[model samples]
Target: MSRSRGSFGQIIFADQSRIYNTSTIVGRIRVCGDHFTKNCYTKTILGIKKRKGGNVSSSFVRSTTKSGRRKGIRSSHADAAPCGQDAPEKDVGCKSRIVETSMPYADHDYSQRPPSLEEQLQEAQKTIACQEELLKLRKNRFFLERFQCDDRLIMFYTGFKDYITLMAVFMALQPTAESMLGWGQSLADQHIIRKGFEEQSPPLIDQFFLFLCHLRQGFLVQDLATRFNVSQATVSRICITWTNFLYCMLGSILVWPSREKVNELLPLSFKNTFPRTRVILDCTELHVKRATSKVLNSETYPYYKGTITFKSLVGISPYGELTFVSDLYMGSISDKEITQTSGILSLLEEGDEVMADKDFFIGDLLSPINVRLVTPAFSKSNRKLTPEEKLQTQEIARLRIHVERAIRRIKEYHIFDRTLPMTTLGSINQVWTVCALLTTFQGPLF
Candidate 1:
């Protein structure tokens, strides 16, 4: 008899050759006759082999055969043995082979269940809702709302409407290069004089004016382009043309008010609140793009922002009308230099009183002009001003507040609030001048 143990079950055989050919046996088999025998095969039996390729010992083989025969005899009486003794052990050994053949491979196609129409609709709704929420948040935080008012209120605000109407008219009046060239051509044909003097195209004056209006209304170039159906380049060109035009042509408009005009337009209360107040003069810095070279940049460099800028000297009458505005100057230039160079000092007459902040050294500039400069008098010799001088300084400051208000209004146009594009300084100056002109048209501040 032979015996073997495997993953599935134990096997017993009267002859090794019979057992080796048979794969499985379940339950029990009993032989009654002397010639009866049992054969079984298991995985362990197949795995058993002598090392070094030598045949197993005859004695060992005989002992294994005896053991197998005893197990077979016991198996025949499995009912009298332990419970579950009839279950075949061979099935256990076959498990690994079965799994390897039956399991899905990595590249196998999987059965997919299609999404329902209802599920797709729900997903789309969720996406739309998320988008709407995001849009709402952005609108609330970043976008400026359009104005809302009844027709009556709109009619009453004729000043605002007039300003808008003028801006629209200006926008509509922009001439194309073709038209400008034609005008030049006509001139050349009719006049027939100079040899090298070819027809030159006029700048886009109308577009530039419209650009100023857009800035005054607080719209960026991109936004203006979208609204006006023009490219950003067109918008930029218009802005540049108009800014330079206004700064150069309208510079003289911003001047100190004459005594007669001051008396006529200024409020009666101003006479009591501030005495001998001719005009309020101040300097404001506008940021600009840094020049390419350090040396050129230093010429325009502002000490405060460490960038190039234009310093504007603004003079406002007691009535809140802009009396004078200086042509844009380099940021490095001092207020006193701008006053002298810009010929604002020439605008002053004898006995005229000027009010400004501490930055303007009135003693040196105004004293020479026979005009008195009023500000908070700084303590000299480490001593405070006398009570009378302090009272006068307080009055001057209160009066000067109106000029500050005027400046605040000018700065409301965002183009001047921060560092503007280096290429657009001329345009910005033009825009500022136009806005100032428009502001004057809005009515006196008083």
Candidate 2:
């Protein structure tokens, strides 16, 4: 077969003086044999398949385009019949020579039309609508329902054991608490004014829950405001209202057990060693912010803590129930001074014994009341303790540590974990008393 080039970038293949033309496009190939030229057979150049009665070898051709860069066109050779061969209409075969040509590279990317200003504004509006709906859902939900089923979370957020225990305390205070003043009213105006924006406050139970969360979690007023969907002033008023309310309500209940009652529920450990022991006493301190006044600063600063603080005396019955929580005093006061002034001595009956730490030197004060003091033995002058004295110290330490554990339980409320700010000074003492009183509802210390 003789090979020759034809016009319009076609290739001619001749067999026995008869010629056939083959045409190509950018990525395709068309073969024509002895059949009418109008009837063309198409085949893909890149992955040409083998037909029966022929063995094929595949390759590609490179030709220069107008841009002077070589472009590749795939072609293949097959050992098949010549152009004059008579073949079936479906199986027409041909032997052709390879040809090289180039065409302009086709552009693959077509950019889409940009959105108009009005359409863009519509999309932005849709996004803002979605965000407002989400915020509305957050504002309308109740905070307590999320914690109702979890006892641990209830204890963590509110210091109550579970929903039932929290509600029990709420139920005790609800009769008076639910009817309290509106958030917008000042504490002094609650009696004079019938109402002022009571409708603006959250549900009464939710308000109570918010108060507990503030105390237990040490949340900021703004944080509690956002969480309860109320203004910061509302949060502050709810906290103040509840603090005073609970202080009055819980304080009215008698926490101290009578001498006879103490004896009935006295622990076996206390009964074996000291049957007359009535209460365990200790002093704890809460750090407070430094004051602007030098005298006020001096009054609040404690030598041991090396910071401004408020000190109070706590007394637990031998059965581990909180018997008394003294009002907060200046931290600089001595343990002995707090004990004497704390009025716990008045509660002691004749022959009643008191348990305390070594720092308490109120033994002389209790002596006139005919009360005894139980404390660990300390070294006298420079003398070390003897073996018998050592054993006695160990026994007293074992018993005295219960008071420390009781104090620690009160400290676990994270509100006291940091220094008290000046802004809370108005309600700080009441908050302190309320936290101690609430510990009674935690079942028992033992």
Candidate 3:
């Protein structure tokens, strides 16, 4: 009888040319020749057998009849398979080889190390030491450049530091004397002045030193000319050039501190003694030598000093800073007239107080601005003060002493303590302004 194979078991099919491919079937059955059966019950080719007591059944053959045909069948089976051939190969022995290669070997070593904190500190210290050494070298160079010996050595020794200190004190103090000498010397060397017989003039540094001594120590123009072996006209011209230069340049640097700043520096003692006091005001006489013209001399002549003089109003703060210095007024002018003419009276405001001597006569000028004037009590018709008036006068005097102290401090500068030479009035005033500015640099007196 003919047999049919089920699709659930292995089945082999061949084309007409005798090429065969194997496939598994899920339904239906087929038989190839008389020896093979494909059915669900078959486990292997050998498991197929003839059924007992039945018509002869197909026997499954385990081996191919030809070896080359078996090889071809195996090749066909591999080609037809749906899976298993593409699976990745396993590396069972690779892990240990990888670990061995990754580890560092004892034959190799690294010697690099980070710097320590001590090394870093030493480097920083060396840098700072170099900077300090450089600064010292620069200072030594500057000292050597300016140091010189001359006839003015004694004067220079006494005033050098003071002069330098004063120059350093105010940004407004011009180096005019130094600059003019430099310019004059250059001009002399270049023969630029008057186009005349060129014998190089004396060094300007020497002349500047002499000029400084004259200004600070009041050396006579004739004396300086003789000392420098120059004409008086040349000396006078040098003085004028330096003085004018200083006056213009230094004037801009002498800025007054703000009233608020002054108020902040006021001492508690001053505040308690004179409440709401704005400034301590006083007028001082600066004597001048006699002039050649009588009319000119009379105009400058001050009856009180019996010599030609000028009047200036000096105002000091509680901290002893020179707050204000009025422009020069003729000595013939009364203190009241000077105060009015100088525009100082215009600064008073309501609720402010100005302490002054009886010479100020500022009551009328200050009253309109609501400022109270403090002065010694005076009786009518030049009469002596009563007991109450005397007590008031004493109280005023006690409060007024602070301004006197401020003035005394200013006069301590020898330039102002002595009678200023008429030839050096412009220079002396400049010196005074600079000295006053220098006082502020010494820290607040209050």
Would you list the rank order by TM-score, best first? 2, 1, 3
Q: Pick the candidate with the highest lDDT.
A: 2
List TM-scores for all candidates, in order. Answer: 0.53, 0.66, 0.52
Among all candidates shown, the one with the greatest TM-score? 2
Least well predicted 10-residue stretch by lDDT in candidate 3: 91-100
Q: Which stretches of candidate 2 lie over 4 Å from their true place?
A: 1-142, 182-196
User: Local error of candidate 3 at 104, Å?
Assistant: 80
The per-prediction tally of clashing pairs is 12, 0, 13
lDDT of 3 by residue, 76-151 (tens): 2222322222333521121111011123345434565766999999999999999999987755531212444332
* lDDT (tens digit, per residue) of candidate 1 on 242-280: 555455444545455668888777677677766567788
Q: What C-alpha lDDT do the candidate models reach, one value each?
A: 0.58, 0.78, 0.57
Tell me how candidate 2 scores on lDDT: 0.78
| Model 2 C-alpha lDDT per residue in residues 1-446, reported as the tens digit of each score | 43444544555555433345563332233444332332233445776532332312233245668998776443332343444545444343353344444335644434667789999999999999999998878655758877788899899999988899899888887889767765456678766763455566788898999999888888989999888778898898898888888888999999989998998988898888889998989999998888888998988888888999999999988888888999999989999888888888888899999988888899899999999998888997899999988887787788878778878878888899887887777788999999998888886677
